[model samples]
Target: VDTFFGDTISMVVIMTCCVVGIIVNVFILVIGYLDWATRKKLPNCYMIVSCLSSSRLLLQGTVLYSTLCQGTHHWNVLRVQSALLVLSSTACLWFAACLSAFYCVKIATFTQRHFLLMKLRISGMVPYLLLGSMLVSLISSVPFIWTDFSVHLCNSTRSSVKNTTGDSTVGNISYFKVFILYLTWMTIPLLFFTASSTLLIASLWRHTKQMRRNMTGFKDLSTQVHSNAIKTLISFLVLYFCSFVAEILLGIPSCLAKSRWKHSICSFIVAVCPSIHSILLIFFNVRLKQTFKGILLSMRGRILSPFVLSFVLIIN
Candidate 1:
């Protein structure tokens, strides 16, 4: 896999991925927030959407800092992940779980108590909760960030450097705590997400089947919207599932043993999913695709000479 421009290509891809992920997720958040604001009285669904978008997007920063800041000791905290990624990811889980619960109640119980619904909506509270969780995550990761891990300024090859894990005992404990959080917070919630969504889908399937052939009218539109929302959520879930696997493949072994290359590869992979989602959304999303095409057209002057020359070269 290591070839000419290997590291260069990988770094570019990683950085590009971060940039795209941040942009797309931020775009999603902005859309969600705009939707919430447009309706004056924010609905529970919009609130949950806003929360999910913001939390997922914020993860872009965590991954970005972690990926770009590699091969360093001083600012190892953001690069390495501590409480930041964990807590943010966890909060995302809670928010999604809330969404799932809201849907379940909406579908099953079918409530119409508008006043009670207003009180139940958590959009207003999301910002404070996010801010608090973020602070906790960052503060907790300090110990996890390799302090003594330093490299000589003379070395041109940054990846070849090693992390000088400072104070073995404290580091070990930090790692253990991270492990616990992984089990209790990250892994558990991921599993919960799968289970809860699975159950909801199953129930929905049974209900639809009971109602005979197919759905129509406003019920159909409502069902379609719900399905669309679920599909979007599924996208996030699939990405996170892959992330969990990558975390194991890249993180566990090194945390248990001592291998920098493996850890480095793992770190790179960790940042991949968020970026992948961004690129997919930008390229495939109808609106985003149109916008991207517009930008390309606007910049066609700069791109054309090189493009035409490359085309001529290929033809010749």
Candidate 2:
């Protein structure tokens, strides 16, 4: 086996990615936490942000650890760190599913109870259920701690222990099994989400049509409501599509000649997913910019206050 130098250009790029991921996701968490405070009622927007932030926190933590270890000699903590990375990745996937389900149920049920359920108490529980289910499912990854990887690189980076063609027969099977688990998780919940959201949109369309027929006045609102529902559905659909691509990449053949290339591509998707999700949220939800502004102001205040106070004390 030819030992390539320990440091590589790929490592540098991946570390840079980790830093960016950490920065973006941390901002998301801060903004989400702050926005959550301002909400007297838990709108679907609140649940979306909360669940997305929960997923990104785990992602950011894993990236931080990876970044810290970058460029260092391969340490022996791969088994433990790899397990943690998997757990974090799994948490992100489950939370995403939970988010979709939350919105599906939240909107679907809202159609029935819109008059009375527009209040705080009922709406707030939607996010709790999403986050709670994600936590429980992610905890199931604890058994990964005992399994050993022959190399000391993180799971996403590790190509596996190769013998003949630089690929492991056993490792490929293991990854295939994990990929199946991810597929099942993504498939089942999103199936329900797609079905429920379809029904919601259909029902909304019909109701909005009826309203349009009845209204002798400003008639754009019915159309506007239908448009908003379409936008909301599109946002959720994009998220699912992105995740679906990622899942398919995970199941790719490990023994292929382009296996390393595939791994590199998959890493980018896994790394950038949260940021992409953030951009989608910002695009679809106008309130996102407001929350972002508040978060930025809060950060700026924290950063500058110490310096400002120190300068004032010296002058006085």
Candidate 3:
């Protein structure tokens, strides 16, 4: 009964993540598309964000399908599904890292020559950076395919009873390989994200100090932009840190301590991160926020219009 209850809770959490993630990512994509349709060209940051949203949508869909398959005992396709999940997740993370770096370069006031050069080139380099990230993600997913193949081959060669020890050995090796892959793929992006956010925060701090010294009683447009940028970066950093810790906990065998509940909670957290972060992005971005508000207002008006008309008619 306890096991059944745990499984039910896990399923509920996974489904919620999938549903919310799909909705949020779809909304992001719609906003991106509408922005592009109106302007005819998206800025580099928005372009990357669109890509991130698409990747996240794919990831969520895959997770949803994978979860359903697990319950239905249709495990045959999970190998490919796992590979796709890894690919999508990698793309999502790298795009987010690129977005952070872009914001840091564009918003931070730095006197360094390298910083200036980066600021100048970032817009033009975004496409190539995204392409490179895709290639890296593809490379990272290749090992998963190999692992799947190796496991299949091993299983084919021996009977289940005879291969118990060999299966255990292969499982251990697979886990180690996955752990290494996670570390390798995640480390550079995590470092880049941390560095960019730190630089932006430091720049904001220095600028605030300067404004105080100058006694600028009124905030300028530039100051407001810096303040907004700081808020956005800090919010993303917090979400990223939480998701990163959850991912690390899920990846490390020792960390789980054979606790199914811990594993389930971490899985749910990982699944929910993209959705939560995307919602935060919408709130922080001016255009997206306005667009969201317009949508809400329109929805409210539509829902209330008929009732309002009926009430007015009765009053008359």
Candidate 4:
């Protein structure tokens, strides 16, 4: 009964997260598209963010499908699922890292010639970088097509005639392959994200300190901009760390501990990260925030206007 109840709760949470993630990512894509349409050109940051949101949408969809179709033994299904998982996860992380790098390059002020060159070239480089990331994601996912994940199954009954040595060898090889794949797919992107975020934070911190030293009690526009940027980055860092830790935990076999509930809980947390972070992004971005606010106000007025008119009529 306890296990059943826990599983029920886990299912509810996971489904809710998956639904929310899909909705938020879709909204992000729509907003990005609308902005691009209006401006006649998409900025590098917006482009990267749209790609990230799209990848996250696919990732959440994959998670939802996997959860719903658990325990299926079809090779083709498993292969497709594994491939999609790798592709989406890699793309999501890579795009997020690219977004971080874009932010750092655009917002950070440096006197170095190389820094100036990077700032000047970043827009031109964005499309190529995105292409490279997609290629890398595809390459990383290709291995899943040929790899046999059956060795990881906890319940495999072997007859006495079965070749134990061969089985052990295959299992060892599979484990090694998965380890390398995880390292390549997860660790590298994480390092890139960390490095970019650190650089941005350091740059912001230095600028904030310099501003404090130069200015008095008066808060200037530059200081305000710096403060807002720092706050946004800090918020992103917090959410990124939470999502990263959750994903790492989900990937680690020992963390699951043979408990479906534990796995479901981790998956739920992972699914929530993308949606929550996207919402945070919308809130932090000035144009998106204002647009969202306007929509809400319009909606409220529409809903209340009828009631207000009816009340006025009654008074008359």
> Which predicted model would earn the best TM-score?
4
Model 3 regions more than 4 Å off = 71-76, 148-175, 253-257, 301-316
Local accuracy of candidate 1 as per-residue lDDT tens digits, 1-316: 4653666666676666667767767775665566568777655565565666576676667766766765444334533454567655566665655665555445532335862474366456555544554554455445445422222211343342344445232232334445554555556556766775665576566766754565443366545545654565567568767766766554352324354455556656667775665454444344445555554556555748567555434423
Inter-residue clash pairs, candidate 1: 66-79, 83-137, 84-137, 149-164
Task: Give lDDT tens digits, candidate 3, residues 116-193.
Answer: 998899989999998998888888776664443233221222421123323332222364677578668977787888
Q: Mind giving the per-residue lDDT tens digits that candidate 2 earns over 258-304? A: 45555555555666666666555554555665555444455546767
The window of 10 residues in a row where model 4 has the poorest summed lDDT is 156-165
lDDT, candidate 4, 197-308, per-residue tens: 8888888889888877887878777656666666766676677677777766665543224556557767887788777888777776776666655555565467587765
Model 4: lDDT equals 0.75
User: CA lDDT of each candidate?
Assistant: 0.55, 0.55, 0.74, 0.75
Summing lDDT over every window of 10 consecutive residues in candidate 3, give the lowest-scoring window: 152-161
Candidate 1 displacement at residue 223 in angstroms:
3.5
- Cα TM-score per model: 0.63, 0.62, 0.83, 0.84
Which ten residues in a row are the worst by lDDT in model 1? 146-155
| Local distance difference test, candidate 2 | 0.55
Error of 3 at 91 (Å): 1.5
For candidate 1, the TM-score is 0.63
Count of clashes, each model:
4, 0, 0, 0
lDDT accuracy of residue 208 in candidate 4: 80
